[model samples]
Target: MGALSVDELVGRDEWDSVVRQHRRPFVVYKFAATLDGRIAAEDGTSQWITSAESRAEVHLLRAGCDATVVGSGTQQADNPNLTVRGNDDPRLDLAIVHNPDRQPLRVVIDSNAKTPADANVCNDAAPTLVVVAEGADASHLNGVVDVLKVKRADRGLDLPAVLTGLHARGVRAVFLEGGPTLAGSFIAQGLVDRVVNYVAPALLGSGKSGLGDAGIRSMSGILRLELVDVARSGADVRLVARTVRSR
Candidate 1:
């Protein structure tokens, strides 16, 4: 048989399980970090953490998801145009076969509506959804991108509500590419079903960690993950794991 399809690698059954349990899209937190688990340098410089091959793998993951999500901090820092750009491989032309014309919905959890109107995510490359606090002023993004106002949580916008809103819009799977705090919030809330981590060989002794405080105070409170797959792309090692929910 040929290489497993993206759906198989991502596990559609797992996605369905999450939807059945929470009535929302399955959430996968994806990120690249240094060997020391730092996502960025001390001054917030995070350009090109992983190899090009690893980045191409990320695009494949994005192509398989119904929606791509990020936090406002990530938006401000990277200003990425959250769209899938499949690699140029004539032999493996899977990305082109999956929704060539349409791009996955780009969702940003911006509690304060601080996303710049001219941000790349606000461009027409893909449909953008901005989730803000109920009373936050979203007028700035009114014409630039779609906006959803929800109750505020400790981390920022209510994450579960945001997922529900995405589900209402027909999203079944969400690829969460974060800037740390947002990823931590999803894990702390037990909303993450899977994690795709790309670990580079380099190390940043003291910098921005890949995850922020996730409310884990005791050893028993530690979150667990069941390793599903592991592969190497250049100097980076990609580890795909599913959250082992506690009983």
Candidate 2:
């Protein structure tokens, strides 16, 4: 074969199977951290953890997904637009010209509806969906973006139900780009199917970890992952792994 296409590399068949089996979108968690596993500095500064090339790769991942998700904490911290960039293919140009909604949907998990109306994620560049807890006051976001109310879990919003709702809306693959707390909850709940991490050479001696409270009580409780791909992007190393099923 000349080279595996993006769909082949992303295992579209496997993703479709997952969607059919679970009635939910196939979830992929993506993040970048320091060599010491810190996602941010002691003061919570996390800009430029990896090189520009690594950041660009993240956009490519977003482009391949049906939706991109982030938690309220990430929205408060990064205020990212969560739109795909760095793709200039003529095919994509034609697609965009034909269909204005070619961009992946931006989903924000905000239990309290705390996302600001002016946040970058709330921009009109792409459609945004804010998942808030039931009975929460989303009046602030009424005109800013669309909102979805879901049952609340102990950690936050009910993830499985949220995924099911997304699936109903035709989201096949979801790219998760939330903070550690949100990521940890997904991992602890066994909802993550794949993880893509970019490890930078720099070290943050004291800072926030890349994963928080995963409920791993002992060595045996640790979630195991099967390393699938490893590559270098500029000075950062990208590691792609799939969650190994429990026996």
TM-score of each: 0.92, 0.92
lDDT for each residue of candidate 1 in 1-247, tens digit (9 for 90 to 100)? 2222458666777678778777988888888999999889999898889998788778777877889999998898888889887647443455444443478899899999999899999887778899999999889887789999999987787888998899999999999998688988988898888888999999889889988888899998999899988878767888888888921
Query: Residue 157 in model 1: shift from native, Å?
Result: 1.5
lDDT (C-alpha, whole model) for all candidates: 0.83, 0.83
Off by over 4 Å in 1: 1-5, 90-101
Residue clash pairs of candidate 1: none
What is the alpha-carbon lDDT of model 1 when measured against the actual structure?
0.83
Clashes of each: 0, 0
